[model samples]
Target: MSRIGKKPVSVPAGVTASVDGQTVKAKGPKGELSFVVNDEVLVKMEEGSIKVDPRDDSKDARSKWGMSRTMIVNILLGVKDGFEKRLEISGVGYRAAMQGKNLQLALGFSHDVLYPIPDGIQITVPRPTEIVITGIDKQQVGQVAAEIREYRGPEPYKGKGVKYAGEKIVRKEGKKK
Candidate 1:
């Protein structure tokens, strides 16, 4: 029994949702998004809410049931309010700035790192040390942030680099003289 799959996802006001076969589509003020549920899960629109059920009483079906439901819910919310992630840069001469639609990062590298911005996603540098990523698609927003952080991951010794806001880096002691 999947506890999460048992509950239906309600279509909130101002957002429209539809389930056609295995494909679930949602449109809202933010934007429009769609998701294809797994074949092991049965998706349907019941009344004003979306319902998900396992195709069979097998372990695979049960495992995919909750996940399918969550995917539908995430898309719905994403199209309505969108998603955002914040990153902070810390290091000597380390900073970030927006070059037109692209992101320019100075993470102590020999040369500046230029990240080309993707469609439907916005990268903004509110301050030299703060980077904000926003988009209607949750996955894209997170992936873009991760790609930017990959350029210069925070080092444990100095905790200097690009990292998620509020992320704690475990410090390591240097060699004793």
Candidate 2:
């Protein structure tokens, strides 16, 4: 028995849910998303709620049951509230700006880097040094943010680079004179 699987996901207002065979589709103010229920797990729509059930107690069923439940819940939340990731530029000359449909970043490099924003994802620069990524798909939002930060990872000395907001960087001591 999976505790998470047993819980019913509440359908938010303005969100619609439908089930067809092993597939579940959810549409909300943000957008629409579809997911295939695991073979060992069963999903059903019941009175404004989505329920997940494990077929059996076999090892495989137990393993997939929790995952399927989590996926369904995330889908519901994503369609309704969406997700967001915040990034901060810490270098002296590093900055970010939105140009047309692309993000222009200056990370102390010789040349500026341009990253095209994909459909359904919004990148906003609240400040020259701050980046805000928003999207319905949590995974994609995180991936884009991580890739941007990788262009200039935080340095241990001055902690200069692009990093997640509120992230802590441990400073390394300089060599003795």
Q: Quick one: best TM-score, which candidate?
A: 1
TM-score of 2: 0.92
Clashing pairs in 1: none
Number of clashes recorded per candidate: 0, 0
Q: Candidate 1's error at 117, in angstroms?
A: 0.8
lDDT on C-alpha atoms for all candidate structures: 0.93, 0.89
lDDT of 1 by residue, 40-118 (tens): 8999898899999998999999999999988888899998898999999999999999888779999887999989999
| Per-residue lDDT of candidate 2, residues 1-177 (tens digit) | 777777888887888988888898989989999899878888888888888888877989888988887887777889999999999999788999999999999999999999999888999999999999999888889999999999998999899999998899999997898
* TM-score of each model, in listed order: 0.97, 0.92
Candidate 1: segments with Cα more than 4 A from true spot: none
For model 1 the local lDDT of residue 77 reads 90
